[model samples]
Structure formats: structure tokens, C-alpha cells
Target: MNRMTKTALVVATLFSASSFAGYEVQLDESSKLTFGGYFKVDLRNVNGDQAYRDYWIGTSTYAPDTNQTSLQAKESRFNVKFTHGAVTGFLEYDFYGGGGNALVSNSYTPRMRHAYIAYKNWKVGQTWSTFMPLASIADALDFGGAHVGQVFIRQTQIRYTNGGLELALENPANATDANQSIPDAVARYTYKGDFGQVAVAVLARTFDNNGVAGNADGTQFAYSLSGKVFTFGKDDFRFTYNAGAAGRYISPGHNPGDKVNTDGSGDLLTTQAYTVAYRHFWSEDWRSSIYYGHADVEDFNGLNADSDRNHYAINLIKQLNKQLSVGVELGNYDADISATNSANSDYIQLSAKYVL
Candidate 1:
């Protein structure tokens, strides 16, 4: 065949294969293995409270009086999967592990983010909490982008999924040095349609502190409804509404809804959160995401009173290629402690990420 014929055949083959799902496979059929994930370097500058910047973005309350700038590659992560017959195991890790500061010694370690084994529709081990819907997350630059109104947790769990129904029994989180008598239970239902995706989750947890003097066990319930809509050729609009003890279960650190009261009692604090975000594509290679999240905290026994907060994030991303992309994000967080005392934090992050 002529050189032109060869080029035409290659183009045709590429066009035909574009519909395949993106995944890489290695190893033989007897013991197949797959590896994937990304390498990311983020250059972040904080306008205030340099002392409190966290591996995860600091909430408004963590703000301090200092301005700081740092260069970090902690978001870099990878995952490995092994498949043998009907059983499969997977492990993933990232460099956000706690140790030294990103701006200081930079002696952080790589920590396990996910480790699980799956058989058919059942999975066991630590992974994303069942109380949150990953499908509703916005494609933003922040590690978790104002994860205020979202359930962002990972724990050891035994989960089963069938069609749209997913259920899990997760390790109890005894935050108050209490002996957990029971495990946390989570259930989620997700539906996918031509329009987009919708998901709802329910969580039940038991909290107890063995210590006497107001140390009591409490059972609380939390739930959430999240959905996503696609528009403008693959752009996504996402929203989530969460209420009840879901704060401790989903977004434990984002705000003050850690638990109810300060007495090591099991009483779950009441909180509500709402988030809305939209991602728009200006061109095939460029996109932007705008998001706003609000969380309300009701003071209980002076346990936590950073009060309610609103967070906003905006970003513009450019895809250099399938494996290389870069973006910049700006985030603002406002805390309403009272009418007279309010605090805010601002941040700008520039990142370049290569995924495989």
C-alpha cells in the first residue's frame, strides 16, 4: 500500500476505536493486572492564615493571620488492580500523608487512599464512603473543591451493589474515645438515565463514650440527595443537599457539625448543606467550573461554634492533551460566627496534572 493509504487506514482505525472505555490492561489472562492514576504538582498561594493550610484545603475557620505560598506534588497518586478469575483486589495511594509541612521540611509520606477487594458486586475494604455519590462531584481544581456540602470520607467497609441499590456496613468512628458497640450503616441508590445521574444515600450511626459523667450512646440518622445534569456537550451541572448527622458522616472536617453537644454523648448534631456547581466548555481543550457551597451549623453545648459558612471556587482548565492538563483555581471561604464577627480566607492554586 502507498503511504497515503496507510495514513487513511490509521485514521479510520482511530475513529472506530474512540468509543471504547478508557482503561489499561497488563499481564496475562491467568493473572491480569492494571495500573492507573495521575501525577499532579500544585503551586498554591494563600492570602491568609498560613499556619493552618492543610493537606486538604483548610476550612475558613482554620484561617490564621499569615500569608503563605508553597509548592507541592502531594496530589500525585496511582492505583493498581489485580484480577484472578472472579476475585479482584485494588490498592491506591497519594502523597498527602501527614508528617512535615509542604512549605517546610516536605517530609510527607505516601498514604493509602483506597484498598479493596471485590467479588462480583461485593467489595470489602477501605474506599469512598457509601454515604456520598462520586458522580455528583464537580471537576474542580481544589483537592476536594469546597467539599462543604458533600460527603467526603473513606473507611473500611463491606459493601454490595445491585443495579441501583448499594449498601454498606462501615467501621464505626468513635470520635470521642468511645467503644463502638455497632458499626455504621450506609445505603445509597443511584440512577443513571439519558439525562444524567441522580443519587440518594442514607446513613445510620451509633456514637458512644464509655467514660461516665454524661457519656452516653446516641444513634443518629443522616441522608443526602445529589444529582448531575449534562449540557453543552459533556459539561456537567451538579448539586447536592445533605441534612442531619450526615455532616459527621460525610463532611466531618469541613465545618463544625462534628457531633452533638460536648459530653461524649452519642447525640448527633444537626446540620444542613447545599452545593451547586456548573462546568462549561469554552472549547474542546478548555473548560471552567464555578461552584458555591453553603453549610449551616447549629451550636450545641458549645461544642463547636465556627458557625455557618459559604465557600466558592472558580477555575479555568486547559487540556494540553489526553495525558497532560493544567488549571488554576481560586477559592474563597466566609465564616459567619455572628453578626459582628466574620472571617474569610482566600486561596489561589495553579496545577499541572498528567493522568494515565
Candidate 2:
């Protein structure tokens, strides 16, 4: 074996031996520490439109049948977790090919997606918020296109989770004020039964000027509800669904294009999103899933725009062995814009992962 492999094996052996030795390591019957990770790389061929849009200008749209493209290292992630007594800690990072024209220029920065510590049922650090419960969907590959209700924000927060309920006092990273006046509050409740699990949550935060003068301050609230149905049979299957709504009311004078602003004007902008997915396991070694997602944004006149977006994806997973697996996904995005032609894009991805 290579030097690194040998060293790792030796360390693992020592750790296992130490656990069996007559030493009090404070082993908990209900909690334990574990390490896990996944790595993914994608080769993409862009067609029929751009992958994402630049709202600042109407131009810069990618056209149909672009050159052969490859998005390497699309979604590679590593995570570690520690749990002892009633305390728990976790850290997870992702290295992915970001979407946009600045792809090559954007250096791979280990995105700190989650880092948090919890005592008893209270948690503190940067992690997913309670408001995100309603926006999640089941997909074979998480690295593919926007998963409709998926929220990818990590912020500093103090949270409490008990039974199936959670509450948090969070400072969303999207907040722009230096004084941190806008505090985001979130709550979630989840219930699991023999058949499935159900979750609901709410997120509320104040909006400050994007560190600019004359921005009016306001509050934004989002609500989400989600559920999953698990079936056990010759072939295991799971169905997941989620729906969410978010609205913001901004006062005049503030930069409408702030990080937290969904609309250009300080006026109120409301959005609703929903997702549904189904996964069927043909055997212990093979599985596949298909999903659909939609999002609608209200316009300045309080009317839902015709410019909604829809996403569809299909994914397949294969377990190579006990510790390795492979996955592939196909995704498409469709958007409607006024005056300008509607946009659509399709992508394909493949990934291989090892678990420890």
C-alpha cells in the first residue's frame, strides 16, 4: 500500500484497539461519532440556452447548441460528525463547478455548507435553517440543477431541537447592515411515523439596505411544508414532496436590488415554490428517481408573473460495493421572460463516491 494508505490503516487500527482497552472513553449508548463523504464530477454539454441568467441586464443570454462543455468536480463534498452524551458537532464542505460565465475564474473554494455544534437540543453555528424544511425534495444526485425548494444558505444561529420541533434565532448571511439589526427567526416541526415523515417550518427576517444609504427596512416571512412517504416491499420506494411561499415588503428609498430583495423595486415581491420526487430501488445495488419543480414570483403589481420557472431531473444510482457508489443525473431548466424569448437548458452529470 502507499504510505498514506498504510498510515491511515494504522491509525484506524489504533483507534479501534484503544476503544476496546480498559479506558473510559465516555461512550454513549445513544450517540456516536462518524465520518462520511461523497465526491462527484460532471461532463456537461450546454444546449438551447444559458444555465443561469443575469438579471442586471437583458443581454448576455447563452444561445442554443453551444460548444461541447465540461463541468468537472461538479459536486464533491466531505463531512465529519461527532456526538457524545447530549453534545454534537458537524462540519461539511463542498467543491463544485459554479454556474456562470466566470466559471474558470471562480476558484474552487471549499464552500462551508454546514458547521455547527449542539448541546442537549440547542445548537449554535452555521447550518441549515428551520425554514428550509418545506423546500427539500428527494433526488438521487444532490449536485444537479436547482432542486426547486432547496435553500443553500448557511448562517450563524442559536437553535433548539427537541422531539421533532426546532426553533432558532439566526443571523442570515444575506443580511447587509453593519449593525445586524435584521435578525432572522425560524421554526420547524417534523413528525415521523411508520409510513413516512412530515415537516413544516417558517422563516422570518428583517431586510436592511444592502449596506447602502436610503434603504427602507422591512420584514420578510417564508413558510414551508413538506413530507415523504416510505414504502417497504420487494423493491423499496420513497416519494417526497414540498411546497413553500415567501414574501417581502420593503420601504421606499432602499436599494431594491439588495441581496435579500427578490424584486427590483422596494415593493413587495412574493414567491411560491413546490417540488415532487419519486425514488424506486430495483435492488440493493440499483436505484433511480425522477423529480419536477416549479417556482412562481409575484410582480410589482401584485400579480403572479408569467415568467415562472420549471425544472425536471432524472437520476440513477448504482452501489459498486459496500463502500463505493456511482451516480448520474440529467437536468433541465425552463424559464419564461417577457418580450425576450423563453430560455431553456439541459445538463448531464456523473459522480463516483466512497464512504467511510
Candidate 3:
């Protein structure tokens, strides 16, 4: 009796599985899709030496010895989103990739900004790094508004979030001789309240490269603190502090957590970065923000070109309509690198945008 009963159960399970495999699945009307992003054009007037911050992440920025003015729309962006049940996906692109070829003078090329999927508190694909907090980023007209203090990084990762805690394993870029196979690791804890949120994030990365400058394989540690505070109606404050092997988290190849030495050893460079900003709303359609950012990198060698810099900016924006806006920002930049050839610059930008 037992054997025959079991046999019948197994046959039923097999028949059910085979029958279901032939069926088709589709998203119902409840599922939704949308496209968005803004069309933006920026006009800039620049005065200063190199080390002046420009568009995007400020990497590979020109250090022209003279002042210049330019107009470009590289910040224009577009994105697509899909939502079905508990799963959501997003894809975003912007034209700021700087395809610096002799051709395409317009520099209008698409670059991936974000591409990821989220399901029930889990995220996968390329997005903001876990070692950085998005809540502290200021709403500035410039592409790299939070230049000095922001731990700006985006990479492929697997992440999980519960309440105020998040953890992720992210892709790491290594070009040295310490060949390794492990990914970068990061964790963060956020505390949210009625007024604002405070988050602390930490990162661990392996540095194994060409062994150049007597550098060897090793591990580096980094951390950041980011927070936001509500002041008045429609007014708020934002700040961020970062330290350690900031690596690409601060800016690609700018100042890493460690410097390779001639002794075939690694020296941990102590770098500190911070930014403070305050935003005020004059009316429902007008607002302004004042921000200051500074980064100081310990010079392990006399030739390091990324030792120190400071940034100051103020922006005034007017919302012309529900789908369009115009803004102007003034910025001052100062850099003292390698204790030599210091430079100072001032910049003003006018931006207009149409949203969709």
C-alpha cells in the first residue's frame, strides 16, 4: 500500500511539472513602465589655471594656463524604468562621457549612469557604491557638484538592505602586481528620523598592481560619514566626511588609500575630505544653496599632484515651469599640490533644463 501510494504521488508531481513548462508568462496590466530624465545645457565662464573643476567627476580636467568660456549640453540625460510586482529595474544614460576624439566636436555621446534591478530589498547590477551615501549629495547644477567631499563611485555589485543597514560586494579595479580575485567589500548603517538621516559607510579593497614604485599587494581601509538635516520649511543642510584609501570612491585614480614606495612596500596615505552645504527656499519656485568642500591628501612623495584642493560654490535657481528650470552657479577653486605650482580659479555657469 505504501509503495503504490508513493508511486502515484511521484507520477502526479512529474505530470504537473511537465504541463506547467509549456505555459507562457507575461506581465499583466498592473505592471508599469516609464521614461524620464532631463535635457540640460550648461554655459560656463572660466578663469584660472588648471585644477579647475569642470563637468562630470573632475578627472582628466584641463589645466590650461589661461581662462576660457564654453557652452555644452553634455549633462543632458535620459532613463527608463520598469516595475512589475516586487521587481523594479532602471537604466539611465547621460551625454557626459566625453568621447574626446578629433571628431564629434559636439561631444554629445551617451554614457551609462545607472543600470540595476531591485527586488524586495536586494539590488544587483551597476549603481552607487555602498561605501558612499547618496543622501548627502547636494542638488547642484554642476555635474560634479559635490566634488571634494563626495565619495563618488558606481560599479557592479550585489547588495542587500534591511531597515537602516546595507551590505555589498562590488567590483574593484586593480592594475598592479598583486593579482587577486576577490571583490571590494562595503557596509553602511543609516539612521532616519523626522528631521533627517545620518549614515556611516566603510570599505575594504585589495591593492595588487604592477608592483611599480616598490609597491606590493595589500589591503586598504576607508570610511565616510554623510548626513542631512532639515532646518526650515523647504530648507536643509548636507555634509559628508571621508577618509582612508578613498580610491575611486573620491575620484578615479585621484588619491588612493595607499601609495607605492621605492622600498617595494605600500604606505597608507591619510587623506581627509569634507563638504558642507546649506539650502534655502525663497519661494515655492526659487531656491539657493551655498557649499564648501575641501580635500587634503598626505603627500607620500614630492611628485604627487593630488595633494590638496578646496571648492566654494553658490547656486540660485528658478523653476520656470513644472517641466523646465534655469539656474546659475558661481564657483571658486584653489589647489596647492606637491607644495609647488599652486593655482586658483573662478568659474560661473548658467544652466537650463527641460524635464520629462
Write the residue-wise lDDT of candidate 1 on 1-356 in tens digits.
Answer: 45576567545554664343235443444555566788888888767533335433324443558577878788888888988888999999997777766466868788999999999999999999988778777787778765766777888999999999999999875454454579889999999999999998899877565554444356778889999988878788999998886545545464433445464555655778878999999999999999988777666325455357677989999999988899999987666645456666788889999887
TM-score to native of every candidate shown: 0.84, 0.73, 0.83
Q: List, residue by residue over 1-356, the lDDT tens digit for candidate 3.
A: 35576467545544665321222222345465555788888898778776434553423244757577777777778787778888889999987676645354655568999999999989999988888778888878877675766788778999999999999999875443334467889999999999999999998877665555545357878899999999999899999999886555674345543454344556456678888999999999999999887777666435454466677889999999887889999987766634555667788999998877
Backbone clash count for every predicted candidate, in the order shown: 2, 1, 7
Task: Evaluate model 1: give its TM-score.
Answer: 0.84
**Residue pair clashes in candidate 1:** 49-64, 218-266
lDDT of 2: 0.57
Kindly list the per-residue Cα lDDT of model 2 for residues 112-162, writing each as its tens digit.
778999898788998865665432445555443344434434467898888
Task: Estimate candidate 3's alpha-carbon lDDT, on a 0 to 1 scale.
Answer: 0.74
Q: In candidate 1, which residue ranges exceed 4 Å CA deviation?
A: 1-25, 49-64, 100-105, 208-213, 254-258, 262-266, 300-306, 336-341
Note each model's CA RMSD in angstroms.
7.3, 7.4, 10.2
Tell me the whole-model lDDT of each prediction, alpha carbons only.
Answer: 0.75, 0.57, 0.74
